[model samples]
Target chain A: MKKLLLATCFLMAGSGTLFAQKYMTRTGKISFNATAVHSPEKIDAINNEVANILDAKTGDIVFQVLVKSFKFERELMQEHFNENYMESDKYPKAEFKGNVANVGEVNFSKDGTYNVKVSGKLTIHGVSNDVTVPGTITVKGNALSAKAKFSVVLKDYKIEVASMVADKLAKEATITLESDLTQK
Target chain B: MRKSLLLSVLSLGFVTVSFAQTDSLMNMLNSGAPVKNEPVAATFKATRIIDGSSVENLGAGVLDFRISHRFGDLSQGSQNFFGLDNATTRIGLDYGITKWLMVGLGHSTFNKEDDGFLKIKLLKQKKTGMPITLSYAGSVSVQTTPAPTLPTGDTWLFSNRLYYTNQVLIARKFNDWLSLQLMPTIVHYNLVDSSKFSNNTVAIGIGGRIKVSKRIAITGEYYYRATNADMTYNGQKTYNALSLGIDIETGGHVFQLMFTNSQGLTDRTFIGQTTDSWGKGALHFGFNISRVFTVVKPREFRDTKATSW
Candidate 1:
């Protein structure tokens, strides 16, 4: 009788976790524009291999991206961004760990869009900073989609721009992200 | 009593599992991730290590304008301004036809020669599995100078001025700081100065680049001729080519300063006809300036977003 009760306790704990809703996407898209206002050439890149996961019960969210996976309009620029700026060999990944502040206001069962405030620690080039951004979460049937736009100062991440290209590369980078996730 | 103790321990394990769930989201996302076969980039900063071709190639749609200048032999003493009195210059234009293929044309003042070459990349090293990068370079040089005066009844044909060279460049980047290359080269001469020397000269070149800083590197190369090592031209014995150089990289430009015993820029003259020996301090100070420009933009810069990814 004691062993049977212990087994029931274990199943209850496991089922509690199994019932928590989680959404994930491996093909999330993240793009950044660092073009200076006076620069003629566009200094922008996009990375489509972003991995993101959201836990609905806890409002916990995470995003991970390989720094070298960002593609630029010029291959040489991509090489410089990897070798010089990001030093991808030393710091290969950029990540964000955060939570949705207003997740309680959203109705996951209903087909509607809700505005959210996401606050997290964003890491890039081996440096981390706390950031908060406004985002939108849309729920339709069994699908969940997220979209956000924000800006990050390059100096905060210790990404140095050489004086030769100082006029071309912007001091702040505007980042945009979009993901279509499925419940798991 | 033992069953009660086991149950307590099992319950403690379940308590820890609840805490692990909050932190395992990143781990869950990474689980079953596909291993990527990413090709290594920037094995060497420039396409040329020292005097020979390196496994590095320019990206497609890029053009490089290269200027190579060699002063006179330093052994000429103060009378020749430490060998700066005479200079041999070669101007070259190299273009990347594709990511794997590059073509070049050059004109050297020393031999009044015009040369054209094609470089093709065969295999590239990957972050894993692959060990080496390989490329093939072939060139043909035509001497445009007037024919030399010959003995009576000696004939000089236009074919005699043509020389062909082929090389297989094999290289490996062992780490971030070190890269080494081996070049097996063959140069065919239509005419030779003497019968003792063969028309086809085989040589092996070994080169290395050591990065000292982000923008500077030390480079060196040595070529040993397997044929006609004992051959003499104009009473001067031939010697192997040895060069040491430094590469300084700025945006859009790579300036290379070197000291070498070979005077010619092409393979035929440098490999087969090098008469100056490093032992005699017969080195020529030289520098090669390379400037690159992007001629075509990648897909990301285009008006349409048609990429599959």
Candidate 2:
């Protein structure tokens, strides 16, 4: 009976650690800007319903966003972004699956901000590309917050800019992401 | 026995820990199903599905300048240059007052008719659960044509020149490629030509849009008047209005080219007073041009320079 009790306690502790290894948030914020230098209209959009998950043990990070969720300054832009650029109906989601390169340097239990390097496969508009981004992760109690900004060539994702709006839209888009997550 | 039990427990814990490490990061989020009750969007590309009001409404603060042109009967052939010689045009401005409400004003050259309408969205369709979007549209058209000279010396009141049309539009977007709508409509004329015919006409309109590509679609609309089916207007027999069009979207503009049996543009004209019959080859080649301008920036992007996040 003593041995059985010890075994059960050991199993419980192992599962508890596994549970604490992951952090997640459904309401992550991600925004992007693709306006050209002399464009008349500002071409920017934001999505607040991004889903993000970070596994502290494995340093794995994942982000998934619905293409239709991105809201633009002009409703027409929003429609064009979905129907023309992203083809939201055909490919409804943009996803990133990657890992933190410096996971061993930061302590997940400590409350501090740590700069990290992340590499991932980003899939947009039914196309996937490998990307690396530099970011910061702040650990506070059981909560973790992350912020990152990166630029991607629109052509890399098969997003085409029509000739009529080529001067208005930049070839590269700057994306900024911020997420607050709690242990799950 | 105790040692064996300990060994099994240790192995079980090791197995689970290894399993956790191998679980792909993307799969973790996928375990939880996606969001629900999200409102569906872009059910129809433009505000009109040919001749009737579609279930779509302009976003708040957007203004659309619409021009509709219809030529005379195509059966007129070379003498009339395939109906190009005669044309009726309506120029309108539609403004979105709120997310759910919109208003429009226009003047048509057909009868020197001036028209205004109000459309309100009552229920929006959802991506998963909700099946249909419902909207109500009410319009008034007044003909400014000279009042007829009455033999009895009766003065024509201003109300006598007015006509009203009320419609309930129910639409469903089944997929990315197909969408359909049904409009149950009522048109009331303040004055009628004959006492035997009722002043109010009841109609049912059916419309659809089929996407041919990302920027092009095929649209069709038909209105069947149940009341006064045999009524005549301007010495012509009335017939059901039928229109078939192709919509081409180029950024901020939507160009619609169509062949319709009705020359009147407003709801009262097209739904209640369409007298040209398709069987007689009285099809009019028409087109509608819609251009939108963003009058107000979205609240989210109003402070574009500020880092609100």
iRMS values for every prediction:
5.2, 4.6
The 10-residue segment of model 1 chain A with minimum total lDDT is A11-20
Task: Write model 2 residue lDDT over A60-95, tens digit each, in one string.
Answer: 888999888898867888998998899987899999
lDDT of 1 by residue, B1-309 (tens): 777686777767666655544358888877845567777888887888876788888788888899999899999999999899988888999999899999999999978999999899999999888899999999999999998899999988999899999999999999888999999999898877788778888999999999897778999999888876676655688898999999987656789999999888887778877888899999999999988776765655567453312
Cα lDDT tens digits, model 2, B189-259, are 88877787788999999999999988899999999888877767766778899999999988678999999
- Per residue, candidate 1 scores C-alpha lDDT tens digits across A109-145 of 8989999999989999999999999999999887899
TM-score of chain A in every predicted structure: 0.93, 0.95
- List the lowest-lDDT window of 10 residues for candidate 1 chain B: B300-309
Task: Name the 10 consecutive residues with the lowest summed lDDT in model 2 chain B.
Answer: B16-25
